[model samples]
Target chain A: MLVFHTALMRPPVIDNLQYAKFSPRIFEEMRAGGVDAVHVTVAYHESFREMVLNLEQWNRWFEDHPDLIFRGTCAEDVLRAQQSGRTAIFFGFQNPSPIEDDIGLVEICHQLGVRFMQLTYNNQSLLATGCYEAEDTGLTRMGREVVAEMNRVGMVVDMSHSAERSTLEAIEHSTRPIAITHANPAWWHEALRNKSDTVLRALTEAGGMLGFSIYPHHLRGGSACTLDAFCAMIGEAAQRYGARHLGLGSDLCQDQPDSVVEWMRVGRWTKRIDYGEGSAAAPGFPPMPTWFAGNRDFGVIRQGLLAQGLSEAEVDGLMGGNWHRFYAESFGPA
Target chain B: MLVFHTALMRPPVIDNLQYAKFSPRIFEEMRAGGVDAVHVTVAYHESFREMVLNLEQWNRWFEDHPDLIFRGTCAEDVLRAQQSGRTAIFFGFQNPSPIEDDIGLVEICHQLGVRFMQLTYNNQSLLATGCYEAEDTGLTRMGREVVAEMNRVGMVVDMSHSAERSTLEAIEHSTRPIAITHANPAWWHEALRNKSDTVLRALTEAGGMLGFSIYPHHLRGGSACTLDAFCAMIGEAAQRYGARHLGLGSDLCQDQPDSVVEWMRVGRWTKRIDYGEGSAAAPGFPPMPTWFAGNRDFGVIRQGLLAQGLSEAEVDGLMGGNWHRFYAESFGPA
Candidate 1:
């Protein structure tokens, strides 16, 4: 199928982060949306072995559907995937649990083609404090060694679900630029996972990229967020941090059951329920904003960004060019 | 490093099987030997998780030593490596211990880039009878299903350590040509692991390949075997089974200590020692024949095969071309 781009010439549309209940329908939706690449979450709280089982499942998908998607290992694959009209699926971990306590697994995961790894998920981890924790102690001693190892091996250190202090510490300590792949600016939405203005400034100053989140919980108006409003937030971020440092992450958790959310929230960390971001009244994946229900909505997001007064080049960068450049820099030996 | 070959043009000198204690020096030796590819043993008696750890170690090797070696997943990688002057490392298992009881892991291991798996190492497994078993009941119930699964995923069923009944059953039952990747003809060595004329006839008739082993235990005169005598044995077997079915495995356990051999022999199967092909007096890996101590000796073996009256074309195929073709057919979805 020839994918037509709304912008005459095609720009690689890369979602810097997503954790959907992926299927054929999702893959087709990616094609329909002209999504050139996706940084997919393959692990959250699973051990190294369980994460490998997840990799096996993805491998099956790669084998079963070669026409639609292929494993993405480097930044050049995005352009290759763009030219070939297929999505390049890059693996990532949403938490450090996949590496367990061993630092050697940092290189192992990278060799297995994992390009992104979050330092923490939603609680105090061995490496750093998660956003859900009350106190943020920042990067642990092992965390320093791990960051250096990740830098040496080309695995990007993601601070998406981590605490503010840890995120700042990582940004300051990392020899190379780090990423907050999916998080809104705290100035736009005061969610716990949202980045502070200080972090956004530090991240952009260090040449880091920030992908705007579309998970309803990260939105100011939640499920009721308008495309104009969301695009407007990105437009605002672009003004603060250069447009080259902004892109769509859209933490889309499409078609997931409430139990998955429970796993993400609890994950054997507590016996008592700790509803993270969600409340007892509504402890499930919140509905995505009406403007962005699925991957097929990226074209409209581009249109919305253009309507928000950003130039075509700037909007193209926001769509995927920036992440493509970041991916090229982030996923290889330093 | 422009690798020149003895055949005037390189024919991708491939060791169809080997299990060296690998390092940069060994990889350099393979390049020196004009070896294009190797089917390397990554597991003997490890569970699925442990095998993954082994994968992690190899992954590290691929990362640390890109100039000398690369991970090979397809037959074309052999040609690619030949041109690039590096050895393509194809993964295999000498035992089905890596898959455990999960049939799904057959495809999982294949997806993880494992191209071959032996049903049994040296004992009765859930899948088939080992050579040392008292009763050779052939393929188990799970064995049939696993064989079909392996056939579907393109993982070759290696029967180098399997009993005659099981080996025969596997050859008859499998749709694709199976391999005894590192065993000698019993007519020459009379070792327990060597193939009989009946089994060799069945295997060759079905287009299967038999890799001549160079382990001292598998050689006719042990470590003292002359290259002329060994090549003459292969030349004789060439008349019996055709040169297309013959290649080298060179079960070279170079630079390894006795403990590694003990691990290979025991591997948590029994509290008591299982000497395997060795006695209490010589309870370790035997010395390799001086003619084939490491990968650097492959060129001389080629010369020896040529001197022993194999046509250059036949010697080329016996070296790696035939195995390369076999790899093309054996490592993709059927």
Candidate 2:
């Protein structure tokens, strides 16, 4: 019983990427890759005020590079980007720090053009416990209210770094479906950050989304992960959770210096170093797989999916179609 | 023991007023009143972004009216204002909307110099229930976390407009002493907005502060309430809660148009007019008592308190000494 805009009727290619060392060169790469819209991480450890500074910085980039990119707030905005041959940057927060402690800010952030927000970034947040936390406390008292507020405001509740219990509770508690914006299935990668079969089933059954990550740490073979293997994993996940619920989230930290990762992992929460997905020895971004090193490498994923025994329609969904539909349906007040 | 700066060694006059149609005239009035610092409401129904815009507007005010006003971030800022003969404008939120739903924003807001934030503003917020709500849900899962975060960040958890249960819970939960920045005792006025003796007992027992309101609706006889009667109420409150836990929060709406009250009462939440406190027939700013009409009237309250059997120290405390001590202690990380 839902109808989408004519702009969204066009075939849309979307990627829900986390963050990178954003620049005009990266915008060029997105355009070259034919990526219509990207859910770009705008905040990690930044507080509400710091996030505003980040938004201000992004505003400058948007003003300065109008030809390369435009700010995307809704599904139609993505189509607008495609039509104009520009990459659409959909703002998101890897953690809910930007909203701070007020539920009223959910709608406020949505009004500011942020389309997605993850409840936690790898620790026990006010809303939900992160995957790295020892015990998953599920949705806290504030989390339920926040999820409802987020649902009402059209801000996506992403559980990319959230624990299993918390993720499941968020999906159950939210009036609208939630999203695992960037994570692989644990069945494939076995990383702590990866989703389990139970999570995927619950997610897809409730009309949620799971954007597969191409981050080497979440890949089966790290930097040497094969396109064929990755595509096959997607095919298997689609067979289980359905193609409509899956898309590319490629947790790309492209061109970012290793030092920035420290902010991502430890932030100001601790004085000591925490390597997160990487070991203390390296504690830096692992080299991306050779086949999917950058934006231009998306085509390799497209071809690999085709060769991995998926129908063309399913392949289209895996690549971007599913995400576009999800966007049209998801990014609005319920 | 904390060592305050020599500037803070001077006697200070403070008021935690909600909002006024701020301008040069009001700042001049504050200077005329010899007001040292004021906790001004920067947000009520504003979202994170909207609040930022509000802060931006305040930033302009501070810049343009340097002689009249300056931004107050720390307790020391009040001292600076006193030394400079300017009113230090300390930022606060009547509602927690500025922080939204992210706990990290509490610290971020502190970083931005928000010294006080109420848990609710006459409605059920994510953190706690406001005074006007039919049902009061105590601190939600997120509320407790936010309280802790606010405590850690030095943002005072104000329960001025929060419901009783929520207010009591906030006072109980916060590691730092909370504040009822503006409200009369229910036993004196019997208004829905006023606090009960039980709340006051718990508040002061926990070392929290209670600022007396001069808002007409919260008065015993509305706008006609006498300064003698008001001073008597403060005298009673001082007897019960101790003089150290009492200060003046006049809740002045000086120079504001009637339309702005509508925004405070019905901020984007309701399409219909909610003549809160005032009836539909006369939904506007009530005439303030003749004895306390503007910033200059603070002296009258000081004189009235002295006449009402309060010692010089207690009168000074009621005027602003308590708030100055509170600012020194509460406006820093616990």
Candidate 3:
């Protein structure tokens, strides 16, 4: 009974957001944390060729650490990772830069194992407006074409870092469910990047999943936020949008220096400086909450959720069961 | 008065096929021939980067001899070339290799000013089967997608080197008019490279154009073929498919070595030699007819067409006016 429970009862543990400075140490940490699969951002402000170079780097990592990590293409890969005692690294793009203005690249990115692509990062893109943009234009012509293509090719259209109108339009226009792969509700903590209740309501109503982000800027108390408080917020969100539409996407930029943050904030778009989410004084990666620091700390969130009076089935769904179902349905042609 | 008649009354003279050993002398010959435009092959079996390098070479040529030739994107460029006394050079690919397996590069190639692309060179491709294949599988799945993309982005689909079934399918599948940019009708000359009546009818019925080839192998009497014989065939073709659907594509290979023919026939697809159009006994370019030996010899074809009793307007259309109209319609979004 103990063996069956350990092997079969535990659900696939998936993290739908990560852009870590990946190394052997992270692979070991992922294994230690029982991570079945992780959606990792492999492109920020890179061209198609540059993004391909990044994929080459990941290919080298996969080859070097086959025992710890391998590439994930579908939901079954998550179950495979669990049975094989390894983690499946799924690729994504934080911005549409990799595709550059070509709608056809949407399918090519899907072919390259990229399961999620955010239409915008933090400003206006060829596709859609980002969260930091002052004016929100829903979806550009190319953005609508790309959304339809992403649906056809089974790539999830992620609006995590997009503006409100654009995100709402994406949810309405996409034939398949689009994801806000890593974002918190603005009701939980007011942040420019946090989504509003209207957007969240439309997202879940469209069968889309909203992965709760533990990024400090999105938390109510920044880096000082506790696991209990985080779990309590998740429980409340579950009530608002139902437990089936919720999952964890810890936007952990682990082991990255401050320079990486600058790249993420202002990727080749500007020259001087546009400090995003951070000011000139504190223009760096914010301190991660002590309770949920890195890949190894997911256990504390699971325990905190249990303490917050959520049923075991609901906890399991949040801990990755829901994502597993989504991956199965969303990673193939419509 | 004669100068104005020579300049304004004459329509644009275009050769939609030429893989010449392009040099300053060739550009000078293009000017000498009163050729307003020529669609030149820029890729055979090149990868995307290799094709870009080839484009870089063309850019250098364009910069070096702006007086002799300029790049053309649409139909008006032909008129512009006639006014400027310069030939308009348009680029095309004899094979889909430049796009490799990525459909996204279809739009990228259009962005780079490639106006035409063939689905196959002389072998099976990811898109469609070539003439040399024993079984013509018609358009593959990627072929359908690429045809739609090519139609959307204004890249003319040229099926000169493809099999009959594939050509017919492309004519049926494409929303826009496709082209047989070079090759004669099999009814006149029984060459494997020539189009059958079924394919030609479908193509022209769908508003496509057929640019007649003057290559010796595709002629009724090979190297000994006469200008009168060629013009008579054109007259017959006009009777069958209307004069507006016919044009000239010379299929000229002036000053090209036999080795270039080898590359075209066997572009890294195999290890063994595929003599293609030439066997072990005769593995070199057959002599071009004396009446049309070089680009400067368009006068003879005109005289022959007039002798064949085609009206001036019909002769004008066959010369280049038809292609100019096709270009105006084909090289932009449908």
For each candidate, what's the DockQ?
0.33, 0.02, 0.02
lDDT of 1 at A91: 93
lDDT of 3 by residue, A192-276 (tens): 9899999999999999999999889989999999888889999999999999999999999999999999988877888977788
Instruction: Enumerate clash totals for all models, in the order shown.
Output: 0, 8, 0
Q: What TM-score does each of the candidates earn?
A: 0.90, 0.54, 0.56
CA shift at A37, candidate 1, in angstroms? 3.2
If both were scored by lDDT, which would come out higher, candidate 2 or candidate 3?
Answer: 3
Interface RMSD of each: 3.1, 8.9, 10.9
Q: Model 1 - which docking category?
A: acceptable
Q: List the residue pairs that clash in candidate 2.
A: A99-B102, A100-B102, A101-B100, A102-B100, A102-B101, A141-B141, A142-B141, A142-B142
List, residue by residue over B207-315, the lDDT tens digit for candidate 3: 9999999999999999999888999999999999999999998889999999988888887888999899988999988889989887898878888999999999899
**Candidate 3: pairs in clash:** none
lDDT of 1 by residue, A30-62 (tens): 999999999999998899878988888887788
Q: Taking the true A–B contacts (Cα pairs closer than 8 Å), what share appears in each candidate?
A: 0.19, 0.00, 0.00
Off by over 4 Å in 1: A1-9, A63-70, A76-86, B1-9, B23-36, B61-67, B75-86, B152-154, B332-334
Cα deviation of B167, candidate 3, in Å? 36
Give the docking tier of candidate 3.
incorrect
If you assessed candidate 2 against the hidden native complex, which CAPRI class would it receive?
incorrect
Candidate 2 residue runs with Cα over 4 Å from true position: A1-10, B1-334
